[model samples]
Target: MNQSFELTPNRLRELRGFAIAARLLNFSRAAHEAGCTPSVLSRRIAALEEAVGGKLFLRTTRRVTLTPRGEQLLAHCERLDAVMLAMAAELRPQGGEPAGRLCVHLPGAYGRLCVAPVLARFLAGHPQIRIEAVYDDAYVDLVAGRIDLALRVGRLADSQLVARQVGSMRRYLCAAPSYLAAAPALHDPAELKAHRCVAFSGLRTGTLWQFSQGRRRRSVRIDPVLSCNDSMATREALLAGVGIGIQGDYMADPLVAAGQLARVLPEWELSTSPIQLVWLPGADRAPALRALIDFLSSEL
Candidate 1:
């Protein structure tokens, strides 16, 4: 005889955990998002598997993959999630203030230097809402990570997501006054080959720096004396006069105004990257999400 599966609150929690784990395909990441331990998540999945009468995932040392059963359950869970969100929207009082958990993903240095400063004011305005901010330079899937919103810088490639251009990011090739004072006279982009440089490992251009003077374009290949993956680290190296490097205007402008750094080849310009706020469609229906979006759109 087969046992019937009942959806108790505990069972619902277990199913939610299963859904998150299935979406991420990694127990560790799923656990982190679920606000629980991996062992606890594993146990929840085990209980869920027993209730469903089969294994949900095939786990190995390298990766996790969903079983056929898990795929079917995930489809149902997604449908349920949509229904719950819609129901909540309907039940909310008209003109009700937004109140809920809002998960946001942001670029590491930019979030700290720009967005982080404005969050306190946002929170003060929406006293009922709680924010979970994840700062990282890596791109994460909004659906898989269960993120409500993300701030991205550069040309957006994800056509599936709705994006709003909040501002523009301008990069400047700059160095400390000390470095420029001692280094050889730097006039043209091509002359960069002779100078010691600092490279950002995360830049798509790699070691090839591109600049434009009107319609004239120039690309220079530089072997850097130092390289860093983090933007803050690169900025520190530049401040210490390690070598000349490209710095974003948001970070470089204040330093430049304060006379800490000097621009190199001011006549040439780097491509401007767009700063955008992105989210999955229909996600803004939630008042809290909409409120945060509006606040950031105006602030940033």
Candidate 2:
């Protein structure tokens, strides 16, 4: 007869490995955290599954996923981790600045033009906090992407994430003054078809440019001579007098003021979007995250 299963010290270590693996959903990452090899983690997890009599994870080539049993176990593991952290904090000195890794998601141009500068100042103050900024305009799954914060511009769909209005964003049709000088005058929005343009590759394949003034909205289909995914690259093309570019207010203003770029349609009002700082609902309480929010709210 097999001996009755027991929750020994070794079993507790195995559970901890399972928790880390489930949180990251990657065996290698979990193994790194445990300071061991992936093969070691695999054997321990196999043993744990045999002892618990249930499959805790489904390992695939692309990713390691949690099974239904794993999900339940993960929740319990998280609660335990929270309790242990709280207990440990109480015993240790409550000194020093908030210290941890913060992985943030940001739009390319906004990250480079706006948020990156702020983070430079922010990191100087919180030297203990480590930051990783991933720039993209596409949607990111906070949980799966391991993102602690995200800055987005525009209306947010109703979701589980909590958001705060941090600033504002406005688009403008702009071009180099030299380009405007040599090219035919563009008096109306419809005239963009006759002009060369710099387009963003991120735009939907068949998407058309839409503009508005007062209550009237117009859409135009224009061919782009240069298409790019990076905002900075597009701005550089615009500076070289390549074509008209749709740029955010923050990006266009300085160039316009410096005589490098000029607004194409001063009479038209481009749609504005709200800039929001989004995160998990419970993330506000994190000392590092809270410090960043306060800094941005005041600065932005």
Candidate 3:
């Protein structure tokens, strides 16, 4: 007769750690999400390995890969996670106040300039919920990162995640009043090549600036005097008369109104990027996640 396996509290905790580690494939990140240290997470995985009578992950100094056994275990863990989520949904009271820890991913500059302000109000209204906001310009895999929600700005590719367009942002070619006053007369996009440019590394077209007027489309390659991955840093450089660069209307409009910055080629238009809220599609949406989505949709 085959022996029956039991999942005790400790075993379940270990398995949960294993599942998170498997998804991330990075012990440090898994440890962070699991609310434990890397050493503790490693010990849990080691304990799990002993219980299963096999090594699950092949760990190197730089990377971690799943063994065949680990892959099989991960498949089981996924199913278990789905079951648990569904069960929680069923057990939760209908129309219950949302309360839990919600992890949110946000773009660095937009999050600070736009989203960060409204968060305090959201928290004030929902006192039971705690938020962990990770701000970065780089795209992250939601599932791998175990993120509950993310706000992205730009054209989105088709993916398995569910997305809702919250708003749109207009891009403008802009520079400080100081830079524009002394620099070359820039009546056209072509003139940008002759001027010192501060390039934003996060732009989809890299250093190529695109503009359209009437029926004419222009693309100009700029050799930047300075390049920055962070939009806020780029804005700071532009404000200090470093060079001309693209700035989101939200960031530049106020400065322009204050006479600190001037718009370049106001006649031409740059394409607008949509702001979206994205989350993994699942059978059960936690009430906290739902509440946050609705709140941001209105606030943003």
TM-score of each: 0.70, 0.68, 0.70
- Candidate 3 per-residue C-alpha lDDT over 1-300 given as tens digits, one digit per residue, 9 for 90 to 100: 014345876777788889999999999888766656788889989988888888999988888999999999999889998898888777665666677888899999999889998888899988888999999999988878989898999977634456788999999998998898899898889989899999999999999888999899999999999999999999999999999999998899999999898998999998899999988644126888888898999988
Expressed as tens digits, the lDDT of each residue in 1-300 for candidate 1 is 026788886788788889999999989888766656788889999999999998999999998999999898899899999998889778665667788899999999999989998888899998889999999888899989999999999987765566888999999899999999999998899999999999988787888999999999999999999988889999999999998999999999999999999999999999899999999655787888999999999999
lDDT of 2 by residue, 113-218 (tens): 8889999999999888899999897878887898899988887763446678998978888999889989998888899989999987754432377888888888
Better of 2 and 3 by TM-score: 3
Clashes of each: 0, 0, 0
Query: Clashing residue pairs, candidate 1?
Result: none
Candidates 1 and 2, the one with greater lDDT: 1
**What is the C-alpha local distance difference test score of each model?**
0.89, 0.81, 0.87
Clashing pairs in 3: none
Where does model 1 exceed 4 Å of error?
Answer: 1-90, 93-95
Error of 2 at 76 (Å): 16
Candidate 3 clash total? 0
Clash tally for model 1: 0
